[model samples]
Target: MSVSKQADIAPTLRPPPALPADGMVISANFSVGGFSKRWNHCHQLANFLARYASANEDDPERHATLLSTFFNELLEAIYRNHGATGEIKMRFRKKQNHILVEAEVPINEQSAKFYNHAVQLANQPDPMAWYREQLEHDVPDDDAQALGLLELAVVYGSKLSISEPTSGDWLLLAIQFPFTEVEEL
Candidate 1:
């Protein structure tokens, strides 16, 4: 079964009162197996963030847009790999100052190749520029793509990082959204 982050904010977890802009905080995971294929986990998580992430009138819409991009693009990357393993794990976490979203999946030879290529493309000096260039010019035949990673960087201002191996060829991709810290009087 594929583990996925849920939209419901867990009861035990609590963060400081956000300035009406930060949305409710929660952490949950679901399986990504055949049964869960129809679910749009990303959108669920995104919408939750949209409603709760401290957002003003103007910011909510923008947050929704960015959150959508974040969820869609990350899922795109995972789907593009086309692996049979049904154990991918996706998470949405709120840190002291930022929201951390992540996805992890098992990698086969085909996915490993794609991962290497995509990582190389995404780790450029200016990832947004690279992503935009590819999006603007990417053809149907272009191999080894990571458009989702690019969109995450460009739209959400989330930094991408790979951590120590959790187990095997399981790849962990995480995006961190840092919130502005307002000093209190």
Candidate 2:
């Protein structure tokens, strides 16, 4: 018998409370087309945000590159897992020594399950090993793999979580980076 670690599907995911404006905050919403219509939009948006966010870092150039890579990974996940029609909302906030990137993605049941499963795997005790196993094996359903979340959690010491389903079918996924370490890298 196989044991399953899937979470009970929630009716909706609630969005996080607005972060205080003590440091820097950037918020944007885009039509689904901005992502689905053109694939490169992910890279474009990621590069733009990363550059702006890393401007004051100790090693701005390297930090920008790191941010761009993770941001692109996140956008790619949204591009692949979103519903047919809905806006993609993004929030990036920096306060004290922490940085938070929150995304509200419109999702159907299928996509919700994908995110939930990914979160489960990312939070596992040996997520790095699981990530390596995934890289070595063949995963037919690539969208469900959640490789980006795993990489962020395992390699960068970022935290991955899902919370507050919107009134509609949406998943609020958050990736938090420890700014001190991120800048050092």
Per TM-score, the best of the predicted structures is 2
lDDT of 1 by residue, 1-185 (tens): 85666855466444544543333354434455641475556566556654555343334565555555566666667766645665777666666656677667666667766666666665678876766666687444433266666555665566777643746467776777654431110
Off by over 4 Å in 2: 1-22, 140-144, 166-168, 183-185
TM-score of each: 0.62, 0.80
RMSD values for the candidates in order, in angstroms, are 12.4, 17.4
Q: Least lDDT summed over 10 consecutive residues: which range in candidate 2?
A: 12-21
**In model 2, how many backbone clashes occur?**
6
Off-target runs (Cα >4 Å) in candidate 1 are 1-24, 39-62, 136-144, 164-167, 178-185
Which TM-score value belongs to model 2? 0.80
